[model samples]
Target: MNGMLPWAISFALIAVALAMIFAAIRLLRGPAAEDRVLALDTLYVNGMILVLTLGIQFGSRFYFDIALLIALFGFVGSAAMAKFLLRGEVIEP
Candidate 1:
């Protein structure tokens, strides 16, 4: 069971990495700012998931902290981008 776990995680990590790469391509080639932002958000999410999968595969807790930080920053950045798109500015002042 233990040996199987690492293999499963490795597969999942590879899948997520592929998805993130696709998302990055979309972000770069997107025709609109909104599309780029959405792709970037997707990339961030996939990256966090990949981090968690790595943590599981290696039996380490270190990646979890990095994942949490990535998620936090991703959320904040997405929110700011959305606000700017909707109102033309991220902050009123």
Candidate 2:
């Protein structure tokens, strides 16, 4: 079971990477700003998943912290971008 952990994480990371590539293509080819933003959000989610897989592969808690930070930043950035796209500004005052 212990030996299988790394292999499982490796497979998950590979899957996430592939998904990220597809998301990148979507980001590049999206016809609308909102579509591009949605693709970018998906990319962020894949990145967080990759980080988690890395943490599992390496048996490190540090990567978990980094993943948490990435998730937090991703959420905040996506929200700001969406707000800016909808209202033309992130903040009114």
Top TM-score: which candidate number? 2
Q: Clash number for every model? A: 0, 0
Worst 10 residues of 1 by lDDT: 1-10
| Model 1, CA-based lDDT | 0.93
Question: What is the per-residue lDDT of model 2 for residues 13-85, given as tens digits with 9 covering 90 to 100?
Answer: 8899999999999999999999999999999999999998888778899999999999999999999999999
TM-score of each: 0.91, 0.92
lDDT of each residue in 30-92, candidate 1, tens digit only? 999999999989999999999899888788999999999999999999989989999999999
Model 2 residue 61 distance off true place after TM-score fit, in angstroms:
0.3
Where is model 1 more than 4 Å wrong at Cα?
Answer: none
Prediction 2 TM-score vs. true: 0.92
> What C-alpha lDDT, on a 0 to 100 scale, does residue 1 get in candidate 1?
43
* Alpha carbon lDDT at 53, candidate 1: 90
lDDT scores in order: 0.93, 0.93
